[model samples]
Target: MERVYIGMGSNLAAPAEQLREALKALGQLPHTRLSGVSSFYVSDSLLPGQPRYTNAVAALDTALEPLALLDALQAIENGQGRERLERWGPRTLDLDILLFGDRLIDEPRLKVPHYHMQARAFVLYPLAELAPGITLADGRALDGLLAACPFEGLERL
Candidate 1:
């Protein structure tokens, strides 16, 4: 099974409950086992004037390929009322593949080691909690990335 990290966030419709439910769903993915989850955090929206988001990170051991895992995550988000009305817009749930077994992917539909993880504290902080020594394909340490992440305003819950 390949190790994978996912970032979860929600800003609409009982955000905390949404995260809890999402985590439950994640554990149910076929051929996958949810192995680690970080503490929930409350963070101001990346975009201004939106409700704060509850965020966390999850680690999984999965036999599914990256694209299949991405499809599963999207299905879970859609089931939870996620809508792509606007980029970075408010959502009921958002699930992003942060890393997939040290693989680097640059597909149009998906990117591993998620493009914005290094710059978003909401992603980095919880991810660090779950996998402190994780390294990028290029060999950058996750803890070091968290230290350099500029975005702040996270409060552990």
Candidate 2:
């Protein structure tokens, strides 16, 4: 089984409950085992005037391929009423494949090591709680990334 990290966020419809349900859903995916989960965190919305977001990172060990896992994640999001009407827009859930077993994947539908994770405290701090020494598929150290990204607008929940 390959180890994978998932970045999860919710800014609507009972955000904390959404993450709890999403974690339950992650554990139920076929051929996958939910391994680690960081504590929930709260942060201001990326775009102004939106509700604050609840975010966390989940780790899974899975035999499923990356795209298949992506499909399952999207399914979970949709089941929880995720709407992609606007980019960085408010949503009930957002599930992103952060790192997929040291693999660098760039496809029309998925990208591993997720495009902008290094710059987001909501992603980095919780991520460090699970795997402090991890290195991205692109060779950037997690510790280094954490140093560059501060826990300014985030609060542990």
Candidate 3:
């Protein structure tokens, strides 16, 4: 099984509940095991007019590869009533593939370790909560990234 991390967030329709359900749904995927999860967190909108979002991180052991895992995540988001209204727009559920083992992927459809994850407290804080001393393939520690991240809206739920 490959270790993977996913970032989940919801800013609409009972955000906390959506986040919880999303986690459950994510765990239901075939050949996957939900290994760990971070407590929910609340963060102010990153976009000018978006609502504040409730976020968390989840670690999973999965048999699927990076692309297949991304497909599963997209399906989970659709199951949760997510819509691509706009780039970085509000949604009922937003699932991001933060890391896929120690792999670094660069493709138009996906970017492993998540292109902007380290820069966002909403993603980093909860990720550190779940795996405090973990290091990515690039040798960056989760705790170190959290310490330097500048987004101040992160708060544990």
The C-alpha RMSD in Å for every predicted model, in order, reads 1.1, 0.6, 1.3
Q: Roughly what TM-score does model 1 have, to 2 decimal places?
A: 0.96
Q: Comparing candidate 1 with candidate 2, which one achieves the higher TM-score? A: 2
- Clashing residue pairs, backbone N/CA/C < 3 A, model 3: none
Instruction: For each candidate in the order shown, give its overall lDDT on alpha carbons.
Output: 0.91, 0.95, 0.88
TM-score ranking from best candidate downward: 2, 1, 3
TM-score of 3: 0.94
Q: Provide the lDDT at 143 for model 3.
A: 77
lDDT value, candidate 1, whole model: 0.91
Residue 77 error for model 3, in Å? 0.7
Error of 2 at 73 (Å): 0.4
Model 2 residue 71 distance off true place after TM-score fit, in angstroms: 0.5
Off by over 4 Å in 3: none
Best by lDDT: 2
Q: Model 1, residue 92: displacement in angstroms?
A: 0.4
Per-residue lDDT of candidate 2, residues 61-111 (tens digit): 999999999999999999999988988799999999999998999999997
Best by TM-score: 2
